[model samples]
Target: MTTPKPRHLETPTETTERERCEQWTDQLFRTSPMVRFMAKHLSLLDCNPLSPFPSASASSSSTSCSSCSSTNPAPAPASAPGQQPKLVIAPCPPSIAGGFSPSLPNEPTSHSSILLCSNRIFSKSHLEDTLSHEMVHWFDHCRFLVDWSNLRHHACSEIRAASLSGDCGFAREFKRRNYAFKLQHQNCVKRRAVLSILANPACNGDKQKAERTVDEVFESCFGDTRPFDEVNNPRLNFKATDEAVY
Candidate 1:
């Protein structure tokens, strides 16, 4: 039997969170029809990445997608032709990461990773929400080879992640009993989008630049949800306060 690629976790909790990540990620991928569609097109490379074969070429030995990312992955290919890319779920420094599609420089691995900050508190529900949010980035990278450095592209993915991940739903607020502010859900998303955007190195801790980028792409990215119909969307009324978003 082919071995599943090894998942890398940066902390001692790696053993535990590995299972948790798989459980959460797989469950979401299975149940969400839109997520399922994205996965089919992804042809997610599951490989024995941690250990390399001696005979393998450098390109095949590592998980590099820069070459493969030139085009959209074919739907349901029986087998992808390159070295399988592992799905690395790891603990990241809160200042620089939460979860994202990163191109690791030193390793030159093409595999994608989602790094959750271990220093912060995380409930199961919170973790699931994070996974869902970052998965959009992964989907965008897989399909569009998105350049995270581009503030506009990053903001667009952030928009879709916030709007589609159910992060701005009233039901979530009701559950948390956090209804003190007007337009609480949308504002919460905007706040989160800003935070995520600020984490990008390009922001250099400039909150204004991050917020401005979010504002510029907010409507377009928030409105565009390919592979998903509107019925599955959250009740987000961003258009009304478009002028007042700042």
Candidate 2:
């Protein structure tokens, strides 16, 4: 007999957090031009909701779209042919703000799932950054031949995610006190990429292995920005100039 997956009842606080995150996610999907562009182009715009939490709800609360001024926002166009992956708001490891899980080999067309940690995300910007970061993984999954099991492949995607998702933008780095006068953006991307790669089980928590893999993929992955025309996606509030430390 197969063992059952564990389930948990959400506390009142957890429920509140989940609802807030779900609303923000829905809002970004509907209203953010960059998010909409990526979702549509990547064919990940429509996502069925799934969760292991007991309070899992399949639909988000109806909120008017500010862009269209419509009480009922128009539904996203149907996803490309396949079993579309879900967008889940569930508990993740305390350290993870969000993640993307690729579909199994048998389900090639279906991209996979994007997970948002209910307890880890604190504000709208945090949610936005996390979603965009995970979407970069989704983009790589769809557009490239990614071997998720390979450390170099995983490192490449993480590096691209960090560079493109505005995770290492100057303002954010400044806030984090990562003040380096030279190659600040590159340094930030490398640091974040190594940390993210270490989270993968294949790295075996070897910081050196993760760092080395990141270096191997760094030059190529750091230069590749496909869906977005450039690094630091135009839709992000921070400008490219902000990345300059001088």
Candidate 3:
């Protein structure tokens, strides 16, 4: 006979935090141009990302993809088809801000969802940043047929996410004490990608291995920004004028 592990419960404070975070996350998903754009693009794709990870497919964009432009632009996308991925609020390990999870092969009907850490997120900005970061992973999975189980593939996505999600903006990079002006953005992206990749169980907490994986795909992955036109332009501006038409 085996005893089941005790179930942990959220205290009042934790529950309040969770609810607050969940509400904000919902609002962000609704109002964030970046999130909405990616969601719309994912919906336009024909494949199911959770359906046992298919071989790499050709990327697709709709006729209205350029609608995200504000002087600059995102790829053109026209209309919608599939269901939007869900944004789930749940407890996460202290070290993790959030995670992107794809349903197992056995659950063909299920799709990938993003999990936001209620306790770890301190403000709306943090929540937006976390959500945007995870969305990049989701976008890559749907558009590129990424095998999340593969370390190199995982590292590439992480690098692309961190690089393209506005996670390494100048101020944030400066705060991290990476003062070298030369290649600061690239360095910040690589360092953050390594941290994220190391969190994966497959890396076994091996920093060196994680760094190596990130390096191998850094050039190509960092340069490949899809669903968006460029880095630092996640199209987070949710203003009505900037919003992409679905």
* Top-lDDT structure, candidate number: 2
Order of the predicted models by lDDT, top scorer first = 2, 3, 1
What are the per-residue Cα lDDT tens digits for candidate 2 across 1-246? 111112246677777787788688767877666565555545432322221122223323222223321222322332233323256666666778887878677765343767788788988777877887887787787667588889999989988888878788777798889889699989998999889888789999999999999999899989877665566544564233312211
Runs off by more than 4 Å, candidate 2:
1-8, 44-85, 237-246
Winner of 1 and 3 under lDDT: 3
Residue 180 displacement in candidate 1 (angstroms): 5.0
Of 1 and 2, which scores higher on lDDT?
2
For residue 138, model 2's alpha carbon misses the true position, in angstroms, by 0.7
lDDT string for model 1 (1-246, tens) is 122234442345655654565455445443544434344434443212222222322221122221222123211211234433344344445453256645544433235655544333255455545655666666666556677888888888887887766666666667657775786756766777898888789889899999999889887776676435542442222111112111
Residue pairs that clash (backbone atoms under 3 angstroms), model 2: none
Best by TM-score: 2
After TM-score superposition, the amount by which residue 47's alpha carbon in candidate 1 deviates from its true location, in angstroms, is 14
Worst 10 residues of 3 by lDDT: 56-65
